[model samples]
Target: MKQRCVKPRFWVVLVGTLGLAVGCGKAPSPRFDSNLMVMDKYDISFEQQQDIANALAALFGTPDDPYVPKESGLDKDKIKLAAGPTKSDKAGVHTGLYREHCAHCHGISGNGMGPTAAFLKPYPRDYREGWFKFKSTERAEMPTNADLERILRHGIPGTSMPAFEVALVQPEIEALVEYVKYLSLRGMVEIELARQTSEELGEGERLPTTAEFLVEGVLKPQAEKWSSAETKLMPVAAPPADFGSPASIAAGKSLFYDVNKANCLKCHGTTALGDGVLNDYDQWNKDVAEFRTKADATLASLTEQRGKAEEDFATAVEALGADSALSEEERKQQRETLEKDKAATLKKLGEKERMLPTAMAYTLVPRYIEPRNLRMGVYRGGRRPLDVYYRIHSGINGTPMPAIANLVADSELPADLSEEEKAQRRQSLQTQRMWNIVDYVLSLPYEPGGELGADISMLGRERN
Candidate 1:
């Protein structure tokens, strides 16, 4: 296993505190002739590398960081992990998800400039502003990756972020974090250039921007750094539990219905077939109706809504008039430039429609007719643990999936409490019966299997 050493904070001046500098008292940072502190902070020194290794001992911790614990998400473990999965690979998987699902709103670069970004609110985490809120107040003062995982699983109430665990597994959700971190880091670098240009050229002239600088210098270095980390973190695929053990399958069955835990049967049903109870629609339908009634469900409506908001913000700025007057000429010019970005963002969304795979997408509806049963995930929209996790947290926005974090955190459970928590109690009961029921369910369909035969691959041809 490659040893992990944390990188020093690249933006040293940004978080400039020297308390950890060990005996290096309140000395001011030595002046640089022309060097920017952000770039210089990254210079790798042997001593600094040692410091990073020490700092990361919690992340690359002795046994593990309890703040963010890890476990086998596999149904039955077959592959043995030596050092455990690295953070980069886990994040890369989510990067792919962004490419598939989120890039439309979050943008490939996560700059809140996705094709649909102009239409969204709070404008997708400008990622460049790397101010993450989920921090630990504990004396140790570090947040776990698990906290991120929880947010992914339960959508934050009153916001746009959605729960995603149902669609992503624990490892896959980990992958999303790495991808976001990559984008966030990139955004930070670009924002630095913006800050510099705004200062240097006095905000009139656009500063130096080079295709080569973007492609060859910045993008290439980042890819190299990230890909190297990814290869080091690729996790071993887990092996299935020994099928013949009987006891293992029995345990898995018990886990399903054991209650107080993964009460999957509530939505999945007792037959392990889609026969279980499902949650009733809550306020989602009403919200969708109200939203669509006033605003079109199509992308065009969202675009219009956002455009109006921008125009309003501009008007508000203009209304500052003499109350907060900028010189007349300066105000006019700033207004023009501000309008350009708003227009650009809106135009970006309209153009993305051309990229939609209308032909292949529609043709695939019934095309080859592959019968892959993926009902284990009933969320319908997604099929991975991370998908479910994100869905729960982010909610369906206009849908019934409410932001569970706020509800649970603030006891927002309606006093009406749908069905008086019928699903909760049902879920608990189902969990209690999980493992044994699954064993029996699987056994019911058993036919002799090859090689290991009756005890092993029960439903297949026997071994010669």
Candidate 2:
């Protein structure tokens, strides 16, 4: 392992007071901020929080000097290339790629609380959750290495994550990918440790810090999930003969509207305008919604209190004016005192309001998930038929969208056929149905809005 160290000055400024020194020496080492949000969710005690933080540092070193275990199967050299301060060596090799490029939005810990994160419409991903929205794998499976690489190369449409294809070479992209895995693995381990120490262990007990226990019980399982993603890629069969034909589109339109089937219209809306469902939260936001709701309630109560205070002040001022025995000087002096007290009360209330959680305060601000506006013809995940196929096949992970891959179950298969034949028939039917839906989605942009039948017939005539 390479042992080059740079001053952690950049991190100290970027993270503000959140930084915790995990090392001690004449020279200070850069630290990875503990996932305090996760620790707080589990109600981890301060002592237990320190234990978890120490274990994370031991397993995966600081941001400037990361340690990737062999069990993670991540490339150490690549991680080294991406870690540390953003500068070129004498030979001109780039290091600190993540800090230079990603930390502004994804944060130093990949917690998605970077400085510019609040301004974006759909916030950058919080990789700590180990859940990604776009991927070619099954719903619950980790995204394949190629999947992550593609996002780096192409970027998501209509989002702040820009493509790094033109700016960085292939090796640089690969290095960043490895670094992301390192951070994600570190985050998952932190969560597990917090849960185990807080819930499983007795009060005042610490998590086992041994390598054997940490690796077997905490880290290896999550690492293995990433390594095995290739095996879980959702199979995409060739499209049927009438795949993009008008007839196929018409069939797909029926499936899109059918509540028992794809029900694309329910979320995408009748005109594919993304106006159907407006109240759903994605998994990331959903996790933090409870906290946001609590803060919102506190804000509401404070507002009510302030209104009551204003009314009380007005009533006191009127009573002071109506006092019969008081001279003008006495009345004015009493009113001035009342004014000062009211001002103090309002100031205190204002301070409390400012301290409450707002969009700018959170690492991942809670936002409602909006279904895609198909009329715009912009797909966040690629517009290719196969890309759409994978989306409809596995569905977008960590969102309201659901997988339709199990359209044909064993019980629904023909009873007379042998088991092998029955399986083959089931596969064939599901593949064809998915393709039909894909065709309709692809044709949505160009098809003019009108009565449903008229639109279909018009599209069919144009194709014919």
Q: How do the predictions measure up, each by TM-score?
A: 0.26, 0.78
Task: Supply the global lDDT for candidate 2.
Answer: 0.79
Worst 10 residues of 1 by lDDT: 362-371
lDDT of 1 by residue, 1-464 (tens): 65443233321222122233423234322210111122122322223223322322222132111112121111111111111222235444222354554555665445444666555443444443343433221211212355445666764433466778677676656656655554444444444443444344442344334545434443444344323432332112222344335674565444444343344344434434433433342232232233333322434566566768688767856675544558878777777777776775555444332222221121111111111112222233333333433333333432222332211211433455576485565443333233233343344334233311234322222111
What's the CA error at residue 365 for candidate 2, in Å? Answer: 3.4
Q: How far is candidate 2 from the true structure (C-alpha RMSD, Å)?
A: 11.4
Cα error of candidate 1 at position 88, Å: 40
Reference-based TM-score, model 2? 0.78
Give each model's whole-structure lDDT. 0.38, 0.79
Distance from true position, residue 181, model 1, in Å?
23
* Alpha carbon lDDT at 376, candidate 1: 23
Error of 1 at 331 (Å): 4.5
Please give the distance, in angstroms, between residue 45's alpha carbon in candidate 2 and its true position after superposition. Answer: 0.5
